[model samples]
Target: MAPDWPAALRVYLGVIAVGNLVWEAAHLPLYTLWNTGTAQEKLFAIVHCTGGDVLIALTCLALALITVGHRDWPLRAFRAVAAVTVVLGVGYTIFSEWLNIVVRQSWAYSELMPVVPIIDTGVTPLLQWLVVPLVALWLARRTVQRNLVVTASMNR
Candidate 1:
């Protein structure tokens, strides 16, 4: 069985939406406040990072719905979006990891910054992007398999 592009896209979007919800819900308290020193820094981090994630979640949801509804369009749009996300995710992940390594290596010479670069921060959320296409393909295949099984059973 082959994967279905539309269904998978929807699932990917759903996953992203849920993930963003979690992120926003968890960080909102920290972001919405004004504080000094480390508290202020964390507040800023929550605002910048979680705000961007909310936008991504919205975009994914809308785009998924649009792609699913447009039955006549080619798959190129979905593929392009997925590929771009992958590239961005991979690039960010590598750059973040590299920065961490550099910081750690020069720890003695450099001033200790309150903020540290987390490798996974840049790498992990891309899972939803990657899953979109893969899951879409899987869904398509499953649908096909189910149809085949049902058809076979009917004949029997």
Candidate 2:
């Protein structure tokens, strides 16, 4: 049977939203927007960060789904989510930090932000990708699995 694309998309969006919020909250101290900026500017910053985070999360999800080899639902979910956490965490961290901070000067890290020893990237952004995705995926997986179990029980 074909997968329900709409339902899957809703799940993905839900996960991304929650993950972005968590990341923002956690890293706010490390990455502050300009305090003197107008409300519109601050809003733009918030939107930009949220949008970028959603894109990265979606990319990770796509890569995970494509790479997951298992036919079994639970195993496939576990593997896919784990893959997403690692791949997106490391890959996006390096790429984005370099592009935004080193190359483009899009955003500057606060003095409070700790730099990773070797990579020279802020620790918060790296942890954001790692922690938020894992938490979001785990929550989504549990919710889906629980619904599936209930549906199966009802059908039986």
Candidate 3:
């Protein structure tokens, strides 16, 4: 039987939120704001960035679902969905870093931040997209499958 996609989605989103929150905090020292900003500002930066990360993750997954997913996603079309979602996320991160760093000057990275060539995007944010969502999807699927099995056993 197929695992419940809705339950999997909820688990996926929850993991995304937690993962992004941790990633944002861990990478704070890579940004200029970490040293230049006050304590409150640093906290705000972490929260704000984490919030944005969550939104991006949600949007990317939703788009992937619309484009490549079906009712049995993460089961039938797992690879297609995961690939599309990660690519969308990574593509958006690249564009956003370029925009914010070059055009808007909304933020700047510290010397500690290692940037990708040509793109000039920080590796941490890029890695965040690659690591967080992938882990989230994996955990979400495993968790849902376990729950479904337990429920089935209980009913038997």
> How accurate locally, in lDDT, is each candidate?
0.44, 0.69, 0.90
Query: TM-score of the candidate numbered 3?
Result: 0.95
Q: For candidate 1, lDDT tens digit of each residue in 32-109?
A: 232233666655655665556545544544554454533422233445544444555445535543564355531111
Please tell me which model should have the higher TM-score, number 2 or number 3: 3
lDDT of 3 by residue, 1-156 (tens): 767888888989899989999999999999999889999998998889888988999899999989988887767678888899899999999999999999999999999999998889999999999999999989877877788889899989
Candidate 2, residues 51-123, lDDT tens digits: the string is 8788778777767766773344333566665675568657877888889888998777778889997888888
lDDT of 2 at 33: 55
Distance from true location, Cα of 98 in model 1, Å: 16
Clashes of 3: 0
- Compute the lDDT of residue 121 as modeled in candidate 2: 89
Residue clash pairs of candidate 3: none
- In model 3, the runs with Cα more than 4 Å from the true position are none
TM-score against native, each model: 0.34, 0.81, 0.95
